[model samples]
Target: MRQPQQERSRTTRRRLVDAAVECLAERGWNGTTVAVIAERAGVSRGAAQHHFPTREDLVAAAVEYLGEEQISELRARAAALPDGPSRAEPVAEMLLDLYTGPMFRAALHLWVAASTDENLRAVLVPLEARVGREAHRVAVELLGADEARPGVRETVQATLDLARGLGLANLLTDDTRRRRQITRQWARILEPAVATRTVRESA
Candidate 1:
């Protein structure tokens, strides 16, 4: 049901998007040019431009691409959690893993660059909002947090905020020891608040 040309185009676009994400993660926004992406993707500059006319367009598309990938990864990780009262800590650890990885690094590059570039901001703001919403939804679902409960949503968001802060620390320094310590401590604190039966019973 698909034409050869259309399939080829899709493949090329995927390669370009993947290459752009790698560049953003490793080189930062200032160094991730179309030429470099094209080379990394093994596509001609013309082909890359044909797919993404501007750098902003390419970066925006890459962000969306990476967001979808991260969401899929989150869903898979959440699905792997066993049904039990003790799922909170493992889920929290998984969430922290998601926040501190390469995808997060690529996103940080975008956030930093977008802070100063209006054109990039125009593309990043809505994408960032959507990613945040999805992350919140996945975290709440995985932790079995009842959003309708008075403070449950805030508690879940606070966990994400803490993980994000630790991830920011990871960007500049080796915060592995602190990250583990905080995750364990926070998981203990969140255990009662995010208990599956407790939240469901409250709801």
Candidate 2:
């Protein structure tokens, strides 16, 4: 059981993580450090060390923070729309939302740092798989795909591939119409897989 001190420690750790996220957003991964995060969180260096023994561990946690943040936002967007077809709407609209803003950029920056860290890669890779798999699962359920179907792997892979490629394109370019075009195109491609019922319900 966590005592009062331990509970406080946990709170402090959360603050540190939040602060580290801000620092990463503000300074990028190379500029973010234990001392900087501790200062940002209003906790001492010792408290920071107590939570994260190394800067690498801290960076790893920041990547996790980014993933959780993105997933939560995506899921919220998922829930706000209708149940079925509306499900496809979020998928249809992902490019616009994902490519915009500081939060995602910060997360991407941390990801680049985490990708190069072998120790962090172990944790990070699974997180990537989970997000991808979860999105694919959503697509499958919405599409009304019969799991026993032989072509299921190819179907799911298509959604993942288009989403990844379209997202990168959206990020690189400033053309909003082009971004919308890609999403709509992907949505059309996704229609057979997730199903019009899900899209209809969502719409």
Instruction: Name the candidate that leads on TM-score.
Output: 1
Q: Write the per-residue lDDT of candidate 2 for residues 75-148, one digit (tens) a residue.
A: 66566655554455466676334535555556666667777867656666776677667656655554455556
- Deviation of model 1 at 20, angstroms: 0.7
Candidate 1 C-alpha lDDT tens digits along 155-186: 98888888788888898777888888777887
Give lDDT per model, in order. 0.84, 0.66
Worst 10 residues of 1 by lDDT: 194-203
Please give the lDDT score for candidate 1: 0.84
Where does candidate 1 stray beyond 4 Å? 198-203
